[model samples]
Target: MAIHKLDIGEFDEIDYSLIAIHTSLEDYRLAYFINQKLHVNLNKSKKEIQITVKEGEAHFSRFHYYEMKKDVSWDLIQNKNEVIQQQNENNQSLFSNVNIEVATKVYMLPEFKKVDYFLKIENSENDLNIVKLQNTLNTIDNIATIYLVDTNKIKSKNNLIF
Candidate 1:
């Protein structure tokens, strides 16, 4: 098997679109080969990028990894409570109080490139749910989100600070 190298940026996140092979290649062999060459680790979650080496198809994909770039404003984060308050202010029925927790300072959106592991589930943002929140944030740049480490309901987290 021959390996080709591409110009992967220092912080560029990987997605399926980065896969360049257009031909119908054997997926298993392809994945194994890529995994062997790339030293791709397999036992990661949907929140991790790895080559999925299966029966007949070998492929690399973002799978479940989330990448966040740091460019967040202090105003957005410090005033998060206010923002939530304002957002939930009008729609008392929707964004109103439920449960909110503050993570450690490190979990707060970083000012530079890094991974955030905690979240302070906002009182108002609970209705949309974490999965929905993740889907919504995926479209925006600079501002990106991930699932809470464990709890599904109130664990929405922004990976990057923006």
Candidate 2:
């Protein structure tokens, strides 16, 4: 695979509180490649750039990425709260017995204290659900920017620009 280098200028404006990367390859491969190419050491431990690789995706976070994931349980807590909030605000059922769950993993870059998150929504067909997930996740403190990357696009383009 061809390696694409990201420009330093591009990162100047980025806030590392929360970010996401979608890649075609496994999270480990992407993280390893990024570390090698960018000359940065990102590891799962040390809280520098907490890296989590799962199911061909990865996340980077400045804090305990996995701990946060554990804390945000999509199946039981977060989704339930979102559903209740949505229903109360709309005064009607939006999901209507449908399971609304969002699967997300986070990653971070210690050098910049920036984070990247991987999001997968169970009801991806519903645009409203997607928006709600994004909005809810954004509420997490210290999150400055969010980047949604399509792995297929990255594979075809041979680079991750942002």
Candidate 3:
């Protein structure tokens, strides 16, 4: 991103997005980063980064990430759910006062009766508060029973297994 001073006789400011040149890292994956640094290697990339998209290719350190908001974080997450808790801390984005967590929580719900991928949220400015309550939840995906909870009040119950 960039900022510029407007020069139409009066002093003003303008902001711009600076696009980074998509480049190849051309390096080996640091095992330490994947392990200790919480970096996930989905697969072995032939190159560190790929500017061009391809089929069945793994671009190293590439994350299909999401940003979790404060309301949703409090609503959905339970205490000490390890994967979510860690992601909430490390990969949080800073736009609003939200805990932007990242994790791929794939579930097999018999009630919802399907498989689904759980990406926390897209961005901070987003407002997505509708979650399917398991007992009353109805979805074609059948595995989409994500609920909103009252953590402090200890209101907890769901049909599916975590």
Candidate 4:
């Protein structure tokens, strides 16, 4: 008899720095601003990040940029999305069934509900200067606040994997 076991922690390594951004600009505009300030071309990903919750499926917009020279990857993702849930109402009148669409707020990281977006930087070779990056992001006029999130304290770290 043989036993096989897989340790999930062995494969789970937090190699990325997560930056929480509070901004009023749209995703595209923010991407543009980041490109201008960071000197990286961030393009919209064709496939959006999708999560299934009790309300419905939530789709989050993602912008990505890969610096081949530095071997660093950057991902800018929307933290909150409005998910429309359809509810069927039963009435005694002729219109017995009515479909009502209700919009619910879905957060990629529920713990960071106040953050509008997250900039995730994966520095494979430890070449990226995260402090400098944060300082540059702070210079953006549209950003109200910019701060680094402690990955160790995050409860929904799995949500960030994608």
Candidate number with greatest lDDT: 4
The TM-score that candidate 4 achieves is 0.90
lDDT of 4 by residue, 37-133 (tens): 9999999999799988888898999999988888888999999999988889897987779898899999999999999999998875467677888
Estimated TM-score for each candidate: 0.20, 0.25, 0.18, 0.90
lDDT (tens digit, per residue) of candidate 1 on 35-99: 44333322223332112222221212221212223221111111111011112243367656645
In candidate 3, position 95 carries an lDDT of: 52
| Model 1 backbone overlap count | 12
Show how many residue pairs clash in every candidate, following the order shown: 12, 12, 3, 0
Q: Which candidate do you rate higher for lDDT, 2 or 3?
A: 2
Which scores higher on TM-score, 3 or 4?
4
Cα error, candidate 1, residue 115 (Å): 2.1
Residue 44 lDDT in model 3? 33
RMSD of 3: 21.9
Candidate 4, residue 37: how far the Cα is off, in Å: 0.3
Off by over 4 Å in 1: 1-119, 124-126, 143-145, 151-162
Instruction: Please report, in order, the local distance difference test score of every candidate based on alpha carbons.
Output: 0.28, 0.32, 0.25, 0.91
In the predicted model 3, the residue pairs found to clash are 68-100, 112-142, 113-142
Task: Give the distance in Å from residue 97's predicted Cα in candidate 1 to where it truly belongs.
Answer: 56
Residue 136, candidate 4: how far off, in angstroms?
1.0
Model 2: lDDT to the true structure: 0.32
